[model samples]
Target: MDTPCAERSESYIPNAIVGYGYTEMAMQEMDEQGFGSDTPSGARRVSGVSSSRRVDRQTGRAGFGAQFRLRFSRSVMPRTQKGRIAGAVALFASLGLLAGAGYEGQHFLLHDERFVVPGSSAIQIEGNSHLTRAQLLSVFGEDVDRNIFTVSLAQRRTELERLPWVEHATVMRLLPDRLRVSIVERTPVAFVRQGSKIGLVDRTGVLLDMDDDSETASKGAPVQYSFPVVTGVSEDDPASVRSARMKIYLKFASDLDSSKENISSKLSEVDLSNPEDVKALIPDHGTEILVHFGDSDYLDRYRKFEAQLPQWHTQYPKLASADMRYDRQVVLEMQAGASVPTNNTQTAEASDPTPAPIKHAAPRPAAKKTAAPERGRPHTKLAAMGQPHFPDESAPTGKHVISSKPARQ
Candidate 1:
């Protein structure tokens, strides 16, 4: 066993080993790693795996053994291009499996009877006043008996908002077999007359129809509001225009009501056609007198009108309208055709409708039957009926267009 030339037999046995054994350099390297069994220790130890480790002073492990272990670990996992391809393929296969599993799970949720919607009873609706349960259920009618996961919450919300009463709405899945619907209804601020039809409108100018309860129940839709009937806002007008008009109307009402006198309640209707004029019809004696509140200074004008009303009514019993656009002076119009005959009565009747009454109102020449009356003057028919008493309900009984803002005269 110690002989170096042990293979040199009689026939040589056709070189039993295919190639030469470890070279001198390999043997040296192996010996450095404490695995040179071919050296003097070959008969004593089979391999370096079973031998005692020679720990280094610095690393606390055999120097060659530790380096060889580090190198072996690096080589264990393939770094070749082919090996990388195989690893990538395995990663892709794992991802595909996960994706397939997720698809199947979602399909189950979408098709399972447990997740199917039973009926409208399974839906929870809240914050609805004018919106009826049946009307709301119609929006999700297609969802009945279908899996809840298949119902589009966003689509349902969009449909709900399209209703006249719904301002905005939120839809959510309650899991399993139910859905939760939260609605914010539009609040009607005024009664709007658009063309021939009368409907309720919110602050944003959205027209709404009365719900079944309000239409047929004890409380009528119009009975809910005590505010004046609004005119000039119509469906033909753009949303922006309607909104703008409503803004002015709201401001006028709010400012007048701020006094706590509830001065807006004195009149029955408000005309918003001319934003600059903002005319309000107030009951004067037996006639409905038009008062121009103008665009701003609502509270001040209302108070001034209240203070000077009796004086104006006392002088002109058939007062038709008073223009309050002027700060100091007001254009007064008594029912046209009232005779201005006597000097004392004509002077008092022709005075300004504002707080400051014109002093010594000179009498104008009596109109000859042959001559036509001057512009801005009442018709002769009205002048002939001295002290006329026209019955006025103070509410809009028919359609009428208010004149544009009068020119500064």
Candidate 2:
């Protein structure tokens, strides 16, 4: 080797190494050249650093452990922003897998029959007064095994409301295969009469059934009649009441009929001309009188009429008609009293016996021509009764005064 000044200064260079076979000074020169040197002193130096043989052997080539360490340190520490992003992505992926598994498990547990309502679960039926346990169960279809919690509440309520009698229903879960159902049943209130047949109805007029015992008992007790029987405003005549007004009429008729014996002879027909006015059509021999009942005050009218009956029957025995519509006045129409028989005997001399032989003096006065009654107010008859010519005030007490003059056509 040639001596050089560049080699002479190598020992002081930090990047240089010197050893083995080469003299210390020569090693120092090689060290100055930045070259690795081998030394027999049981140590080795490469590029100014001591290293294991494995490291020295791997140092010249790409190391798998070094690549692995770079990746592993990034994964373990996650110190850099890029490393943190990778770590977050991996953590999110793991969490997503776990969440997916948990969601699927919950879905399967709730919907699946094996996990939710098993076959061994017990069921209970409540609010079953009219319906039996079997009847209630049959409504849910044959697929259901009577496990209450296993079945959906919405499904069970749908089944219950379908029943004919159930107006409303509720289904509840008791847990552990137990179920409870409550029901509300429709109830009847009255019987709506339809010709010969009657249909059961509620108070609101909802039709339920025909000839049902529940409806009949709820509506009314049985009533018997020889003539026609009508319910719910069968007639629309002026003498009839409206449908909604029939309840009071039926009740009153029922009560009146109970006392038939006292009123049967005097009353020919019951006229409901005014629902408020119960007119009694009474017959006096050949003629009839429309006796107006004062009002709904039936007790007072009945008592007054009952007291007047005895005297009227005797005095007006042959009277054509009588009007007792007024509280104070009673009008009498006489068949015999109005027309009195007048006998005219003309005296003449005759050859036969008896009272004709006696001649009487000639009468010197002429009778005045009598005018017939004008309209219903008879002037002569009114004058004979010694009363001023005014309209008849023979109307029922409390009734508004009506004009006696006929309404012009």
Candidate 3:
């Protein structure tokens, strides 16, 4: 009778030793025939079933590895929008906490008194000559006690510079409890005269206040300054015109300052009332003489006048005014009733190339004599006077002299 398949399969493995020997023999036969060789129907079915089981097990293992990789990737990466949003929120929260800590630290530093300027002893000032220490302190005002971190350096500088003598100011914190201030004071170049009021002004035309008693004391004494007074510039004038005039005045003053004779020291005032013809007042023998100096060649003209001043003064003892604007000649205006000395004719002719020769005509007859001139009446006459010869080749060779009319004093 045909046995059932299960029963036949079970009888094939009835004993362990027999089953193991049968398995080894099957493996040897398979190796000898090659793994892919065709076999009997029963062996073929068993081999096909073993191969399918192995392939299924390998496929299951591959699927399990793939699933493991997918789970690991999902765990490590922010795959969902919610996960990405949560990460962004955590990053911003950390930044906010850092910002709050910084804000608190800064607030504490600003209020700290260790950085505050306590008093004048803790503050160092430099470059101030005309401005007093009190004046600079006043500029700090209520902000003196404020912490250095809270102090407005720009504002303090502006306030310090507002003082008339301060041209520029710099303010800075010098570490814990100290402040440093440096000032550039305006240097007075000349005095400004406007309608009887005199004020000090710098080369740039900035007016400096002279009304402060502290400023005078800072200079060590209430002294009278011997600066040349600049006239004719008014506050009503346009700024451009005033600036131009100031530049011209400074140029003239500088030239005088450079002279070997120190002519600037003798200068009493500068007359700019007539812009075309600038005049300078110089004290000569206790008399203030008005000197006409045209716009150019200030140094050359001044030197020439200085060289001939003594000779001219000797010749004309009462010299009232002088015109030195001429290239080669300087016209002299003498006091009325002054007679030209006879011996000076040769001296004057030798010194000046121009001027009519001194000629004495024969006395007119007595009949021509008119009524004696009134004693108290003033007599004015025009006289042409020659100038001293200058060795400069740039001077004009042609002879020229300006006639002068003495005015009643």
Top candidate by lDDT: 1
**Quick one: how many clashes does candidate 3 have?**
0
Query: If both were scored by TM-score, which would come out higher, candidate 1 or candidate 3?
Result: 1
**lDDT winner, 1 or 3:** 1
What are the candidates' C-alpha RMSDs? 16.0, 29.4, 21.1
Candidate 2, residue 55: lDDT: 30
After best superposition, candidate 2 residue 106: deviation in angstroms? 2.9
lDDT of 2: 0.41
Off by over 4 Å in 1: 1-77, 80-86, 195-197, 212-223, 284-287, 336-409
lDDT (0 to 1) per candidate:
0.61, 0.41, 0.60
- Pairs clashing in candidate 3? none
Q: Which parts of model 3 are misplaced by more than 4 Å? A: 1-77, 115-122, 194-198, 211-226, 234-239, 257-261, 335-409
Q: Could you give me the TM-score of model 3 versus the true structure?
A: 0.59
TM-score of model 1 relative to the true fold? 0.64
